[model samples]
Target: MDILADIATTVLSQLQKPTLAFLLGGMMLAALGSKLEVPTPVYKFVVLLLLLKVGLGAGISIREADLVSLAVPAAAAALTGIAIVLLGSRSLARLRGVSPMDGMATVGLFGAVSASTLAAAMAMLDADGIAYEGFIGALYPFMDIAALVTAILMAKMAQARSRNVIPQNGAATMALGGTGSADNDGPSENRTLVRGILTDTLQSGAISALLLGIAIGVLGRPEAVYASFYEPLFRGLLSILMLVMGMEAWSRLSELRKVAHAYVLYGLSAPLVHGAIGFGLGMIAHQLTGFSAGGIVLLAVMAASSSDISGPPTMRGALPEANPSAYVGASTGLGTPVAILSIPLWIWLADLFIGL
Candidate 1:
């Protein structure tokens, strides 16, 4: 375990940039009108697995020590992240005079944290027995969906302003899968946001593990059920999921270079902004909690500094045709690299101030 952790940490330090390139290459092809073949049977299960992974991941890394001390702080940090990436980014986009579609994409990009980035962090921590692995569960797909819904509302607003099309934010549009908007937040946008998050929560593998945890908590079969049904499956599923996630991220990033130049600002500003929010939330969580270890508490404070994998898919889908792809490329392309440094660095800083 120690050796594996060491390897994972080393990769976090060194191999992440190249890995980003690899992952982005694959995701880009699919996004840019590539018809990638996915087995129909796996799609539904994959969604469930993704959600289940999010929940169990919290269980895996967050000890009873953390749960007792840091749970509320973690929740606060997560909510703050959602607010920043969703609403804050939207305001910034409008100020920049970006189109409705482009603005919505930016909002979603900011709103959603990356799962793949967290996976890298998980590998590093897991390898070392310094198991801060599962906290990345905070960076779920619901973030993307929420932002997508926001983007669509923003698009409707833009249409209304330009062509006077006050498209009702009705149930039919709400039933539509991906509309990006932070304004003109209609009923449909609200409904989809609710549905998406509910889906991510209940339908995901996270819910499955949470159910198992609840069951065990009730039934007193942690060892028996954990080993018998959950452990092996979770480990296997995590490994497979990370590998595929890497591949998909690579594919998505390949097209970023074709977008607008302003995206560079997004790439640069978002991490710094989000990381600061994460640290602040962590500090608040720590001050109020009973977690005794300063180091672990510091790490918890940085909980909102999520995986940066979400940059490409969310942003690429949202940007307007008039915008150069390079900006999106630059932002999405740099996320993994930035996280490699930020997570550990902030953890250290939090310790210096908060630790004994």
Candidate 2:
């Protein structure tokens, strides 16, 4: 009875957040055909600030964490990201009859983490006075890059097998839906390709903020000054960001609706399935390492999120032949909202599993 009460309380409180309220408001206005808009630059700035603040805050907390404690969770988190991609890809391809390249793109998008979702999850944990491991944010890049690379490899292998050409240097001679080339561009091209992708991934505002925050947390003493600014201002920034996101999502509702019903199903189900799997895995990690309920919840949140900023561009660049609307619409349009909406449910699940 107490647990049920706690779940209800969590759900209500999460719904009442200013950030979530703004998100709903944005969606409502869009439905009403109001033309109010958040300037692109302004939205970008707020999102950047939000991510940086969260990352730095996490980093500060992470300094006291033992690497041994984080090792299993981090490894599990990365593997979970890969597993979700493989599952999403197979389901998209076999179930929906989507082409291999397009399925891989979907995998890439749904497999990676969403920075906004992470920020929102942390905010919820904080609001509820739940204590989570801050170093979980460090797993962000591992999961992000892992999903991208796996998707690329899957696409490469499928394309190669179709053409009966063994990939020489991997992803170098293989373009999506294009003939595999026998020419070895040598390792130089492969190295260059990896370098370029890394550069782009690292350049994302959220990622860069996380990385910078980690650096500061590890190397500097700005916690007192930084916390003063980040703690108080974080939710407000996230609120504005969510509002903009809601408006953007609402505007794209028509585009999302046009996606295949099968894909729509996949998008809706991916987060739920992945998040459940993630929570189960977190439970395993907890048994192994005695991690806190909040840390487990964070792991679950990481797995549940669908990528918004990082996954799409990589997919667009690699799988140009794929339908942009299908992947983008499915992930940003369906998956993200579902993940955000489901946070409370995950919290409840975490409690059941870990006794939070």
Candidate 3:
């Protein structure tokens, strides 16, 4: 508990600020169209470690050295987590009457991931010598794509609602999706949606590294465990990822002043709700899917991670209505990890109660 508390304070207070600054700077440059960019290799490296850490951590925990035994649990867990995210988000959005964008933001968040948090958890799990599997991390990219697509659709819905209204400061130009100006003005957006997804799948570029990692794993190549080269590579990547992620966090916090209450509420509630839902979902999936307890636990963990990318940034970035960064920082930095750590203990208590 103390360790978790320390992580929460350190991550939210220290790390997040830096993450924000860097990302905001990068985004502004991208949006305003500054040529300055994080190096391609650097971006890829961070994302790679992000995937590796999660995969290795889970792989180390599963200890399926033969690679064959890993299949059942990984499959069961991934399917369960994805299903919960997809179905749960759509349901929640409709119920809340949140605009399509909000629903997408909410639901999309359920799929996007936090590479940093996953990396940290993986490292801890690795050090503890717990055997996990690659499949868990492999699923991350798909999760990302799902979230992004959903967000786009949601954004489109929100846009449709906006109709003919003139957005402040040529808002149409800044939006994504190769979208034309809302008032039919300015240069059109590059049709990156399908192209982006395809490029990611085929080229293994910055936005699609997770998919690359997944493909590598799916093809039965978890051999990185025995290889020594990946560790140094990961260390180099983590430093950059952490530094940039920290900068992004800093920038994100500045946005919080606009919607402090909603941010705090999301921060507080999301982790607990998501965690419980994940745990329950994992259990149910286990029974239905015939996966092991460890496998089920992993599924639950994935579900808890539903908010990884979308949930946090939504709170932190553009929309003041829901501060995703705070939600993520507070939850992932603190809530999810604590939840993961508590899971075994919780199960033990549950078993004890049942026995009594």
Q: Give me the candidate number with maximum lDDT.
A: 2
Q: What stretches of model 3 exceed 4 Å from their correct place?
A: 1-46, 50-103, 161-207, 216-226, 231-251, 306-356
Estimate TM-scores for all models: 0.57, 0.89, 0.54
Residue range 236-262, candidate 1, lDDT tens digits? 554444445544445536655455445
- Residue runs of model 1 more than 4 Å from their true location after superposition: 1-54, 57-71, 86-92, 95-98, 128-254, 291-332
Per-candidate clash tally: 43, 0, 45
Predicted structure 1: clash tally: 43
Measured by C-alpha RMSD in angstroms, how accurate is candidate 3?
10.5
In model 1, the Cα lDDT at residue 13 comes to 55
126-239, model 2: which lDDT tens digit per residue? 878888887877878777877777776677657666865545444345443323444455255456556666777787656787789878877788788676887788888888
lDDT of 3 by residue, 63-90 (tens): 4434444454444444544554455455
The true-versus-predicted C-alpha distance at residue 57 of model 2, in Å, is 1.8
Instruction: TM-score for candidate 3, please give it.
Output: 0.54
- Cand. 1 TM to true fold: 0.57
Candidate 3, position 161, lDDT: 40
Worst 10 residues of 3 by lDDT: 347-356
